[model samples]
Target: MEMSELTALLTREGLALLDETGSVESSADVARSVSRLRAAGHSPDLVSAVVGQARLRVKARPKFGEFADRMLFTRAGLEQATRLSVATMHAIRLRRAGITHVADLGCGIGGDSLAFAGAGLAVDAVDADEVTSAIAAYNLAPFPDASVRQGTAETSLPDEGAVWLDPARRTAGHSETTRTSAADWSPSLDWCFEVAQAHPAGIKLGPGLDRDLIPDDVEAQWVSADGSVVELVLWSGELARAGIRRSALVMQAGETHEITAAADADDEPVRPLGAYLHEPDGAVIRARLIGEVARMLEAGMVDEQIAYLTGDAALTSPFVQSFRVRETMPAHVKTINQALRAHGIGRLEIKKRGMDIDPAAFRKKLSLKGSAAATLILTRTTSGRVAILADRV
Candidate 1:
């Protein structure tokens, strides 16, 4: 979003028109609104900004819920904003730690700041981007205790208070931007680490961050929401839990389950394929807590290097998606197709690990033409690569 468009949209007529425009879910709706507004003598900049924001509000609903209606957003800002549910958890953690005021450095679109204020904590949010800081202030307008400013993370640091650091991981732009490497990240990971070490802080990082780069003393927690691993956070000082080096928090169906260990748990020994196969959640795998989950299910690894777990028990947990084995055969596509056809399997869900096959490409090679549906698990074992036909339990 350009500064001129933002200037136009912050006025009375522009905001009124945005509310009157209602929901714009399609390009056709945008076109109609643009034409209608243009015909009615509205400026092109105003029309563009209002219609563009309407479309963004529709897209932002999944992350921000009803709050997206009154809030403002830039294209890149909306994409990088944290989900409200996850941000609420962070706020709750700070509140529980007896922190009353927080300085949110590198606060993009003020997603976390909104949660902090909603949780009854005072917020001082700062973003280097001018438009993003403006939108953040508008979004946080309802909370008298929250404030937003335009400044770099370094210059905006407060003398005292807990800190929430979210270094910008993308290039400088409000509309379209590419990811910046760890070295190029604003406020740099090294500087963020120094801040965390000096004060009680929570540093949010990408889930796929290299494990070796993590500090030894901070508590590392990987979080997954509704089956997708979202973020990894490093906690320091009072925020860090004692004796817990790694943890996985899984949120699904409105319920949260967490597993914590002093360190990465040891993997279970590889064993023969059992009656049931369990696929661990991404959070569990990222946190390297699969052994803890395996112990809970009385399961063992399917391969020494594979993440798939096998067990004779038909047990299931929130940590894994379990399947009951029906048959096992060679991994060859022709033989697997023949077995699938013989079993009258029509619809198939292909899952693969420890193999190079692309599920989409391999699915095209299958001769599926029956009434039954099953899951085809393609993985490698101690013996060899095999295809196990199973049904979700």
Candidate 2:
């Protein structure tokens, strides 16, 4: 369809036009549709509606296809943006730390920039891709002073209060290459360090970013939502405390785990599993502060090799859940099926760790029935694969 037709359709439908044909050939069709809609005078509400609908439809199909749309992999020149949760957290941290001006490097779709601006901070948001920059401008249009520029961090950032760099980790022509090591990251630690030296800066990195490469002068933080670690935040300048890395678990309702590295100093101590076992948030996991989490709970590993931490006392750790182990077993497909059958199991809550088998497939194979319900955890300990029947503590 012609651009005018697409725009008119979007305006009439009050939704963004997502040409399936165009989306299939190149996901840029969505961006083109958005541009056409804009040129034809469609409102952001209408455009967002259409795009949101298309995204939902696309995501409902297959995981890989969903990734394509989400990552903007099919788009010729669009850069996918960070998730809202991560952006909001970053903004919160920046504001809390009293950062007033920010250079948002790789500001795709301007999610982080908008959050920063909304938090009353002056922001210079930059992207190398023209289309992405334009979209970011549109996204940030409501903020009167927020500037959206098009260029790489090396050329775009100005001397400011702090620099926020989220480098493109995915290589060109590949969608699954999500490595967070300094070696794999674009704009490199060298570039980030240069920016940091110029001004106090914060770099948004993958949760799995290598801890060893983290600069000694900077503070490395892992941030999680609920009990899952989502991203790593590296801070430079006065904010970086010596030998005191921080890990945070943030919940939407404002619960947080602000753990310092010093908590783990001296020999690692092991405590027995308590009344409750709390899983650390994903951010804590990425920060590799599981040992600290265990300490916080006064807990020890269920089996040394497993991520499961147990304690005799109930403690607050936002990285993991506090589950009451109701039962235990040597896990086997046949044995598990028999146990479920014996319990008259119908509904199964399956959880796994250190296991390669697909849960859905295992559930299907069991063909469970009856009214019994149980939480099944598949994990490896110092011993080996075992199943724990657990209840939320």
Candidate 3:
């Protein structure tokens, strides 16, 4: 069927067809509909609604398949591909700073743009892809001053109070290639830096990006959500008044750990690893300030070479999590099987740190049965297969 006929069908049928037909085929149908609608000179709002409904219907099932179609049919649809929890925290931080006018460069599917607009800030949202731009326009339709434009951030935006840029880290094919140069992404740092010079700006980068790659003038922030490193936030203008670096841990319920970036300050002395080994939070690990974390916990490194930090006193630092050291097992497949059998460890929680062990094969090898749950951590500290029962702190 042609794109227009499919779009007309969607406009008449709503999204129930998507759920009935399954996302794979539904997405193709949706794409065809979008093309038809565009050809028929449909209003952007109607196009946006049809596309948004299609996306909302298919997003939960087989995400990538539907996502590709959405990106193809709707201008700003790929923005929904990656939803950064840390970005929400950054927007909150900016809102608290009393910044009113916000421009979101590369505003994917309007996640951050909608967030800022919801927070009562005027938003100028831009994206390079036509489909994404349309999706963004629809996504931000409720906001009064939210404007979605189809253009690169360098060209679309005018001077504004604050700017948010999420550089495209994943390439065209969605491969995990390291971005060594700025030109690789749509809005290059050369453009972002110029925007930063004009007004307060926030740039989002990969969590694993090298610390040295961060510009000295921008406040580079490593953010983690629920102990996982999600993204890096670089701030310019008054946001960087404290320093050029920072770290944050954002919990699911909007709780946050905000820390300044001062690497040269005197670090608290390290103590010996005690009975408990605390795993540092993702933000702290990504920020590479484990020494400071040890200071906060009054913990000493068990093995200076290892990432594990041990401490006698149980202190709270958003950096590392506290885990009770339960039992130590020998690093052999048979030995592990024997231990699991001995302890009646029917259900196993396999966690790996510095070691390389296939979780699936290990679970299958044990062939566990019964109603018992114990957390097994496979890490290469001094030894391997360190099994410990962990409870969240």
Candidate 4:
């Protein structure tokens, strides 16, 4: 939003009108609201700001929950913002470490700052973008201890308190942005590393970040929400847990589970296929702690080069999705399709690892005519490629 529009939206009249209009779900609602507000003789800037924010609030619900109703957002800021649940975990870590104040550097719309403030910690939130800083200030207004400022993270770093850095990994834009190399990130990764080394800090990064870039002194944690790997966070100094170099945090079904190790765990020896095949959560696979999970399930690697684990025991855990083996067949489409047809299977779920074929394209080539359903796992062993038919456990 422009400065003029933000100024207008901060007014009593604009806020009242926005609250009255409520959440906008579609372009039709936007048009109707615009027409009504225009007819009421509201300024075009105020109308645009209110309508735009109403739409954003709807999109923000999944991340912010009910708090989104009274909050403000910009498109890109909302997109990059951390989810409330995940941010709360970060806040908990700091609080547990005896940190009383947090400097949320590169705080986009104050997502993490909200969590920090809500946890009863003083928050100094900073963002480089002017409009986003203003929006963050508004969102954080309810917390007396939270403050938002517009400035580069380098200049705004607080002399006291733990720091939370989520450097801008994209080029600046309100609606659309282009990804940047780590070297080009605002408050460059090198600078972030130096600051982290000096203070109790947490650096939030993309889940796909290169392991080689991770500092040795920090604890690297991979977090997954539901089934998706969401982020990699590096905790430094007092925030870093002792003897824990790698950690996987899984948040699913309102429960959180963590597996940590001093370093990447060794891969289990590959063996023949077992009765059950387990697919580890992405966070587990990313943290390279599959060996730890393999021991828990009494499972062995389906292939040394792949992440799939297999065992005969009927076991399941939140760290992995288990599938009961039905049959094994040659990896050829004709052989699999005939087997599938013989089983009277019409619905199929395709899973793959260590294979080049596209599951979607492969599914199209099959003649699915029966009523039964099965999952097809396409993978390779030391011998050759094979297909495993299975059912979800």
Candidate 5:
């Protein structure tokens, strides 16, 4: 939103109207609300901006929970902003490192800064965009210890006890951001690493960042929330573990699971598909800790390079979703179609790895017609491409 509209939104009338209107759940809902506001003689810009923010608040419920109502967000800022739960973890980590003050470099909308302040730390939050920095200031106003600055990180580095950096990975506006390569990341990774070396720091990065570029002495942690992989973070100095170097943090509901290894493990031996198929959690896979899960379940990889595992027995754990293998089928879509028809399978949940195929397009070609439902796993063995039909266990 433009700064002028934001200024209007902060006025007594605009805020009262925005609260009175509550959340706009959809585009049609926003349109209807806008029409009603215009009929009431509200300015067009005020109506548009407040309505847009209301819609964003509704969309942001999953990330910020009740706090979303009190927060302002840019479309791009919300996309890359850390969820409150995850940010709390970062704060706890910082506090444990004896950090009483934190410099949140590139603090988009001050999401992490909010968490740090709540954790009882004084914060200096910086954002390059003026409007974003202003919104961050408003959000952080409740925390007297937290302050925001509008400027580039290179120009406005906070001299403080510790630092947290979240480089902007997108090159476009919040509404339509384009993911750029690591080289294009703002407050570049090289610069972040340099900063980390000199300060007790943590840097947030994309989960898919190249492992080779990661520094040798920091703790690299990949975190996932509610089954979706989120950002990776590198911790250094006091924030870094003494010996641990890699970790995966899985957060679901009120439960949190974690796995760690000092270094990558050797690949498990490839074996034929077993009675059960296990798909490791995304966090585990991202951290290269699949072997740990395999060992826990007494399973082996279906292919030495594939993340899919096979076990003869059931596993009771959160690290992987186990499926009972119903049958093995040919990888050919036509043959699979016939097999599905014979098995009375009308519904299919498709999963693929180590294979080049679109699950949605292939599902359409099946012309599915049956009373039964099942999951289809398409992957490769050392031998060749294979299909394993299974049921969620």
Candidate 6:
């Protein structure tokens, strides 16, 4: 966003106008809102920024909830910001570790800072972008303990005993550029790790971070919020666990579930298909904790590399979604469609692993007409690609 646009957005007039405009659900709605605002004599830049932010607020509802309506956001910042629920976990961890003050380096729009301050920790939140920093300052206005600074991470590092760093994983501004690999990070992953060693620190990273590059001594925690694996965090100093080096944390609704291990867990033995199947949660798979989930279910993997698990007896756990095998169908698309028809199944939920077919396109080809709703698991076994018709258990 331009400096003038941000300045305009902060005006009493702009705030009143934005509040009145609210969220527009579609392009036509947005156009109408924009036209009304423009015809009412608002500046072009002000209207554009307000409209863009309104759309972003709508997109941010799932992550920010009611706060999205009040909070300002850049597209990339909204996408990269930690959900408030997940940020609460980070705050609790820091508090438990006896951290009273934290330096939130590379803080984007003060998402994590809000949680940290809400948990009674003092936060010095820093962002490199001026516009984002300004928005963050406004968003964090409610918490006096939180201070947002428009500066680089290095310069804004406060003299706090604890720290949290979320390095920029994208290019400048609200661009959609993905900063692949550790070196692309704004503060660099190596620098973040270095700081973590000296203080009670947590560094947020991509869930797809290379396991090989992870330091052996730190606690690497992969978190999935509402079924989506959002981030992997590396903890060090007092925040790190003594024996545990890896963890899978799952957050859904308001509940949090976690499983920790000493290292990347070993895979369970592969076994043939059984009466029941278990699909491990994304966090479990990302943390390589599928073996741990398998043990909990008294099951073995269907394939060594695949995360799918099978056992004769039904088992219930939050770590894995359980399903009862209804029938085995041929892997071919035509045969699978015929099998679905024979079973009187419609409204199918297609789940695929180790397969190349597009579920939506394939579903369209099937022309499903039955009244039944069932899950179809398209995956590969040692015998090759197979389809398993199943019911949620």
In terms of TM-score, which candidate is strongest? Answer: 1
lDDT of 4 by residue, 103-208 (tens): 9999989999999999999999999999999999999999999999999999987898899999999999888898999989998999999999888999999999
Order the candidate numbers by TM-score, best to worst. 1, 4, 6, 5, 3, 2
What is the per-residue lDDT of model 3 for residues 1-393, given as tens digits with 9 covering 90 to 100?
123433443444434433333443365777877676668686655555555455554553332333233322332243334353544566677888889888888886776776687678889988776555665675577778899988887676665588788766545321133445556766666777777778888887777776776777777777766556667877888666474365555464457666555552233344443567777677766666777777777777655455777766767665666776556666666777776677677777777766667888777777576677676666655443354444334
lDDT by residue for model 5 over 1-393, one digit each (tens)? 888888888888988888888989988998899999999999988998789889988988898999999888888788788999999999999999889999998999989999999999999999998888988998899999999989888776667689899988888565787889888889888999999998899999989998999989999999998988898999999999887888999998779888888977555778888899999888888889888888888889998778998879777468888899988877987888888988999889999998989998888888578889999999986557988888998
Model 3 residue 111 lDDT score:
66
Q: Give TM per candidate.
A: 0.98, 0.75, 0.75, 0.97, 0.95, 0.96
The CA lDDT of each predicted structure is 0.93, 0.65, 0.63, 0.94, 0.88, 0.87
**What TM-score does model 3 achieve against the real structure?**
0.75
CA deviation > 4 Å runs, candidate 1: none
The lDDT leader among the candidates is: 4
List candidate 6 segments past 4 Å from native: 365-367
Candidate 6: count of backbone clashes, pairs at least 3 residues apart or interchain: 0
lDDT of 6 by residue, 117-235 (tens): 99999888888888889999999999988888888877665555788999987778774656656677789888888887777889999999888889987999999987889999999
> For candidate 3, what is the lDDT?
0.63
| Model 3 misplacement above 4 A | 1-87, 171-183, 264-273, 315-318, 367-370, 382-393
- Find the 10 residues in a row with the least total lDDT in model 6: 173-182
TM-score-better candidate, 2 vs 4: 4
Query: Model 2 shows how many backbone clashes?
Result: 22
The stretch of ten residues in a row with the least summed lDDT in candidate 2 is 70-79
Ten-residue region with minimum lDDT total, candidate 1: 153-162
What CA RMSD would candidate 1 show?
Answer: 1.0
Global lDDT of model 5: 0.88
